[model samples]
Target: MAEEQPFALQRHEKLMERLRLHGAVRVRELADALGVSELTIRRDIAALADRGLLTRVHGGATLPTVLDETPARRRRASAPAFTIGMVVPSLDFYWPQVVNGARSAAAAHGVHIQLRGSSYDQAEDRRQILRLVESGQVQGLLLAPSLEGPGVAELIDWIGGLSVPAVFVEREPPRWTPTPRPLEWVRSDHALGLELAVRHLHAFGHRRIGLVLSKGSPTSAHLAAGWHRACEELDLPDDFVVRESVALNVPGHREIIGGIVDRCRRDRITALVVHSDPDAISVAQYLTEQGASIPDDMALVSYDDEVAHLAHPALTAVRPPKTTVGRTAVDMMMARLLEGRNRPVQRTLVLPELVIRASSITSSWQRETPPAG
Candidate 1:
């Protein structure tokens, strides 16, 4: 049998499912259904409410009436002052949160978002962007393009020539060249997120921390920079840095992870900071299989918060402020479209938060140990 999930996470999953099936959930009913106390149910409702995931009524929670519309359906709403075309690398995982935030912000500001999903390939990015541009159905663009591809310079040049206003989401332009016009951007401070993860492990009495980056992600460079800087500032050992990212989906991932684990063991590294949650979870599984104790022998922190809470032992993770990045991109687009040349180039960097969990602490330690009796 599978191990039971943590109370908070279990409740959250059930609560979301209940809401989906019943359209709303009553606190007392949910408590009785889940075999938990009414107070616990109430707390869950309040937490979900605070996150804007649900609407809390006097005695129950209901879905947000108009705001809960699907992305495609939402786009069909009555034409507004502006229609913004958005293209992101992936619709799954991290990009969804950013899209939701953008949609919410657009709704609030009486704008419409025409979204398109693209793959990691630069050609796909260009194709999707060109489709949006050719459609001529949108007045502005919000893009999270693949910046590392060989065609990056050409892509930049094309975007520079677009007639409509454009704002990059979770991406920044190269600083080496002056473009025809100023570019606007809104991105999460991924570097700070990495720093936060390193600092968190350090606080747990880990001196030598290893870093495993995802070579495929643009965020890896920023994360590596932060990892090095934090080690220097905190006076911690930094020789265990892995310059290459371990791709979790590849066929030889297991062997690669085994090598990484062996390196950690040889270096006596007590903790690790991984680029994304999936990679971190893979490392955890490998460690468990190798007879190493999590948190006791090795503490772990994942960079992205997407599914870290679902990991065995529930990983501590750095959550990028995705929603804010999306919302801010829309806000910047609005300013640029409305103010025209009067508005200066807008650049915003939102901070990420560290979500602490059982994985970050030593398994042998208690949260509140009793004094000598």
Candidate 2:
């Protein structure tokens, strides 16, 4: 009991800190972070709830709210009242988890989400958004519109001017200058995600590391920022970077990847962090075809976990909390609809998770994970 007291106290402290930061805490996440069992985390949550520290919700605990934020209580006694229109650049890849997460939260709150798939084009995003708005079916919006190009500033203003409340899913408002209105957003801290990857490789005795970014991705800028900042902090070289789409279908992809490989050899880079799985997998396939080995020849860490495990060597990856981002956006939407502008503007930043696997680790690496889940 005495030995357990200190550990329990530490766990309680962490739970409170996370709740204060993100407004909620998940049981599975807490267990993983603390290296404890889910049952143990539940018990800790119970103890905390008994102290009026938090309100227990399904699979998690949240800040105590008078309306009872738990889904068990909020589960539609009747049909939903409000409908939220959701638009994403792609229905596939990174957006699905986020959409599913929104669906989960919306179901709990007895709300409907009208989803529309758009491309990365700002004009297409506007067209989709306008169609949803012009239909007069939605009272709120959960948008993942293109945050690039010259027209983005005007788009941000237009979204803000809409009669309904809006939440940005995995997107942020303009950063170059302030918008006419304070926007609400939730996104994975991709910068910090890259930092995690860089630091992880550094600890594994990798002195020189490179970063390869997918061209034209909004997330790429954040990843690059993180790579530079982390490298600077670690005193690692920041010279080796490739800012191009090196995925399989891209024109001259083989030559593009070949150049990257040749550069790594010339620079003696021992580790590389590639943004997104397709690019990472391309590099992996090319390396294998050339008879080089992963982690042995060049340790590889991919940015997105989507399909990273499906790669030949099973890449270690930075998994952005996509579901959490979506859930949080909906939660904020609920707050906005309920309290209106009385509630403070929220621009939440959720961190990404690093899933260790075969590609980024050798036998001697301490924090190793199973090759397949």
Candidate 3:
């Protein structure tokens, strides 16, 4: 016989087993089998649902998707049940997980998602949204557009005036003006994510922490807000802040990353929070070139989890729940279709988690020793 584990762990394990065997599990049945109350089973299901491990239905939980089900079968079965058009900023990096999560939820609810890719440019965002709107086949939309650019106001008004139900994914409404039409939104709490990173570095004995933000990222403002707030709350110095976009492939990019590395070295900054994985990778490389060992010499934490694991040391990162965000967006759209204007506008902020790795485990800072030519 195997040794017993904690009750919650045991219950969750058993639930997974049941889902694998039956494709779904009812709360009453699970409660009876586990000798627990139905309420306990419901709570467990809710927790599992939040983690994207399972999808909660009226009276039971189901496996998120049929792993063996082919796309052809899924499309054939779901055949325009409730067509939803989705426009996202990019098909590569970060957004794919969001799309997959939405697809899973659509499959569960017997709906279909029509996906379109766009760039960060306002014009491009509008083009994608218009393409979806003109399709005539879609009754709803999920959009992640350039909410910060000059065209944002016009775009928001256009979306608000749309005849179909729409939901914003990974974007928030402008607080500056009252929306022409009520809109629903779902996004990761990037501000909270920054605070999580700061706390993690602080826990590891890093005091003089620094932050580097990608210039045009939508989440940068929220992250900076969190960073500053955390610094104030924790009584840590917050003087070292860099706000620039570094394109490693561009000419003169080396100097920008080199400058950042030099500043950190001179300021005795023990830890740094870098937004997005690509820039973080560049900084890590530049720092290594300066003879600074990651974690040992300077602790590093990347904000976006998308490709952070690919870094040399496998970065500690704040991971937005991309999959869950996608899945919930679809769910919100479904609710809007069913409830119409009867349901209150939903604005959800999903919490992000810090994935600890080798890059942020040092107990003390080790100053960089520049490499000899």
- Candidate 2 lDDT over 3-34, as tens digits, reads 57547766777777778789999999999998
Report the candidate with higher lDDT, 2 versus 3.
Answer: 2
lDDT by residue for model 3 over 260-319, one digit each (tens)? 878887999989999888888888888888888888888999998888999888999999
Which stretches in model 2 have alpha-carbon errors above 4 Å? 1-74, 175-181, 363-373
* Model 2: worst 10 consecutive residues (lDDT sum): 69-78
- Which residue pairs in candidate 2 collide? none
Tens digits of per-residue lDDT, candidate 1, 1-373, equal: 1233245655776787768668988988888899989898887776555445578788888866666533223333334756899999998989999999999999866789999999888889889988988997787999988889577888887787787768999998886535676788899999988999998888767898999888778898788889889999999887887755554676788898988888887988889998788888888888888888888889999989899998888999999999989999998887666445444677888999999998988855645545578
Q: Which candidate leads in lDDT?
A: 2
Residue 42 error for model 2, in Å?
A: 34
Q: TM-score winner between 2 and 3, please give it.
A: 2
lDDT for every model? 0.82, 0.86, 0.84
